[model samples]
Structure formats: C-alpha cells, structure tokens
Target: MSPNPAPRPSASDTPPRRRSVQCAGPHGLHRMSYLEWGDADNPDVLVCVHGLTRNGRDFDELARAMAPHYRVVCPDVVGRGLSSWLPVKTDYQLPTYVADMITLIARLDVDSVHWVGTSMGGLIGMLIASIPDNPIRRLVLNDVGPVVTAASLARIGQYVGMAPVFPHFEAAEAYIRAVSAPFGHLSDAQWRQLTESSVKAVDGGWAMRYDPGIGEPFRQTPLLEDVSLWPIYDAIGCPTLLVRGAESDLLTRETADEMGRRGPRARLVEVPGVGHAPTLMDAGQIAPVRDFLLAAGAAGGGR
Candidate 1:
C-alpha cells in the first residue's frame, strides 16, 4: 500500500494579512500600524485591542483564524507597538485611546464595528461602546471588569513603571516569559512572537516597545481598594462577551459573575490553565471569539 499523504492545513490555519494606517494624534499625525486580514471591503469588521504593555501583534493568530468572514483589524494602540509613543506620558489615558479609535473608525469609513479587547483595551472598549452614539455594535471584554482589583493593580504597577535594559533578545524574552506566566502555556513560537513584538534593539541591548514614562501616571495615581465603573458598563447597549482566565488575578471570579448578572449581561467564558487574559491564539480560545463575532455581525447587519 502507498504511504498516507500528509494532512493539508485548513484555511483557518493560514497566516493573516498585515497593513498600517495613519491616525491623527495629539502631536501631529502619527502612523497607527495595524494588522488587517480578510477582504478590505468586508462590512463585517472586528477590531481587536491588546493589553497595557502588549501591541496589536497579539491578535495575529486570532485574526488569521477569523479572516474568512470578518475584516480583522488589530491596532497597536498609541504608545505601544510600532505606533508612535506620546511625548506627554500623561496623555496616555483612555480618552486619548478612544479618540484615536474614533479616527481609525472614520478612516475605515464604517458605520460600526465589533470590538474585542484584553485588559486595558477592554476598559477602552467599555468606555467607548457605552457612549450614546458609540460605533461598537458588539463587545468582548477579556480578563477585565468594571471593578479592578487592588492586588492586580499593584502587581501591574510594580513592573509597568520599571524600565529594564536587557543585554539581548534572549534575556528580554526570558524576562517577559517569567512575568507573563499568568498568561499560561504559550508555545515556543508564540513566546518568540511575543518577544519580537514587545522588544526593540537599542544600541547594544533590547528594550520594551513602550515609553517607560507611560507608567508614570499609574504611579502618580492614588490607590484604592476598589475602583468601580459600573455606570460606564451599564451604559453599553451592544451584545457583549466576557472571557476570564480561570486563575486570573485581575478579573476575579466574583467580578466575572457580577459582569454577567449586571451591566450588559455579558456572555462569559473561562479558559483553563490561564490567568489575567486569554491571547486568543489557541483553537479552543479563539472559537468563542469567532462564534461571538459571527453572531454579533449577523445581528448588527454586518457592522
């Protein structure tokens, strides 16, 4: 008998398309680079936003998987990734992010969009989508909620403000892996991608993509036991999905439950063996998002 042929990869396994768009920022016009996959003309637009320290590249695998039907746009929020960092770190707040996103939406010339956000990105979506004339038709909040935990905030603050210099990419990657253990079980390739997108070669060493001063506002801010934004979430009118890593220190089980019970009554999913956030790279992780977006698109007239 002839040897069995090798299995062919499915379309969903293919790589994503990439592109960059310039968006107006506080200081002149800056290029807000994005990874665009699927047909440019597709009315079904899904915008994926990354976490505080992460860039748009975090959604590469997820975007590739969803490209068959949706135009997946993953933007490097200002001050992160290939996007230009703000000269004034104080401007690195949600209002600025929301404004930049508005500019991006206008540039796309779309009526509305489906939003998927992780951690800090989730907060931006929650704030923007809650507006009276918001353009987000459906929302996905990954590992974040209206009430942020002090413990998680403290943990993030510990590192967010620190500027680290690494002798090489290996060292930088190792450091990232150590701190990002809460993300859980990423493959060697995935880890490498994260490292590459997060660090840049500077002189003889490697450093993070963001401005270290960006964290100054966080440090200068007052600490509180609980910071509530239930009003903002309640204002959201779109269908919403919430994903929480089972062991996440950030989005507590209580918060996730409350998120479902109140405020948009978001559909909730929990990923095992992960914490803080889900990267949406794995099939198991990406499936819920794909399903959610499809349903949202169908309901929102392909917004």
Candidate 2:
C-alpha cells in the first residue's frame, strides 16, 4: 500500500524540547538523550520508546498531544538519535536497553510508569514489563508482539543494521521514504521530518544517527521459523494495549489476534493505513493512545 502524503507543517513550527541524563551502561557511563514534554513535576509519567533505527523525536507529536495529561518522556535509545553510542556494539541488545530504562526510571523517581513502544522498543518494554516486580503500570505495544515474521525481520535486517551515508539530506530522506514505505501513508512533510531526525551532519555529508556497528549483532542473530513469546506475554500483570498497522508485515495479523486472545488480553487497535508501526503523530493515532492511557490509569488506580 502506498503511503498518503504527510501533512506539511508551517515554518513557524517549533520542534520538541530535548534533555539528557547520564545512565549506567556496560561501558561505565553513557548519556541518554530524550525529548520531554508537559509538566516535569507531573507524577503521571508516560515513557515512549521508539523503533530500532528511529529516535525519541518520533514521538514529538504524540508527546505534545499527551503533555496535558501526563509528563511524556521519549528517550533516544543508546546508539540512536542524540544518545551516546555504545562502546561495545554487542551491548546493543535488549538487556542493555532494559538496564538503561531502569536507570532512567530510577532517575525519574516515579513509583511506576506508563509505557509506549514501537517495534524494537515494544519488545524491550515487553521484556521489562514482564519481570516479576516490574514497575510499568500499563503498556502500549505499537506494531510489535512476541511473534515476529521472518519476512519482516529479513526486510528490517536488510537496511536497519546497515550504515548509509548520503551526500545530502534530500537523498537521505528519499532513501528513508523508500525503505519505510511499508509504514503506510505519510505526508511529504512527515517524510521530511523523519529524514531530518534520522540523519546527522558529517564532515561532508549526512550519516545515520546510530552506530554502524549495531548491524553486527543484528546480523548474527538467527531467524526463528515460528517465534512464540507466550510466557513473556503471559507474565505481564498490567493492563496492556496493542496497536498495529493494518498492513504491517512485521506484526502479522495472526500474531496481533493471538496477542488479544492471550495473556493480559491486550486490547487491539488497528490503524487503517499503516504497516509495521504507527507513528502516533496525528489526531487519529493519538486518540486511541490517550484513551488507553486514561483507561489504564483509571483501572489500576496508581499502581
């Protein structure tokens, strides 16, 4: 399915604010940069984690929309966006991400948090929230589940794990759009924002925000024919919401259906024109999220 052209934002538009926190990493210390919106003192903390190659900025629109209700924290996973790169590329696995999140949560000093994750981020959230004494009160898994498709995994492995340098931002944007077309319809302006957010100015050209070596571990992981994460999903005790792009290749329809039927009985919301993931950047996307968060909060009553 072809992506719809993303709406254009005016020149006067202001991007989201960013802040950094030093977190303990395998290599001693690392700075994790994140985009923060809403009241810092608001105890209602909502942590939004982005996809593999994507950054925290992906949640800019969603954060702004959710700020009125909760303090939205969107972190740039290590080795991605403005976050510090990992010294050991092998440390780019889920355990490292969970550890970083734990440090971030400790810094927040919040008793519990509401989580929203896309793709790889969703997997991280699932792993963490499934722990025996996890602090996540509610979770929203965006286009990701325990059972991932090999075809989608292969497609992601083809590009995400690689480092691509472009002579100009336009070229980089075009490349991202081409590869991410599976993400459904997005406006030209949205595509532009995505391209701008993902690339950094190098000596003469632009390079991806993450370390090129990340692909090393990603490539080495073997693909499973039939992935089942039932135990992990079953262990989650909090209210859960699952959002999937209707045309997503990564989160198969069958997996999404099974997710709803299984542990926690995740409520599923399918975005009509998206695939692989939903970027919660528009009203249509944000509504379900806001509704879910409110419902989760009401149901749990301050867990």
lDDT of 1 by residue, 95-128 (tens): 8888888888887888878789999999999998
Clashing pairs in 2: 3-185, 4-185, 5-187, 6-186, 6-187, 6-188, 248-276
C-alpha RMSD of candidate 2: 6.1
lDDT of 2 by residue, 150-269 (tens): 888777778875656788988888888888887778889999988888888998899988887777775888585756687998888778889999998888888888888878888899
How high is the CA lDDT of each candidate model? 0.82, 0.82
Task: Give the clash count for model 2.
Answer: 7
Error of 1 at 155 (Å): 0.7
TM-score of each: 0.90, 0.91
What is every candidate's alpha-carbon RMSD to the true fold? 6.2, 6.1
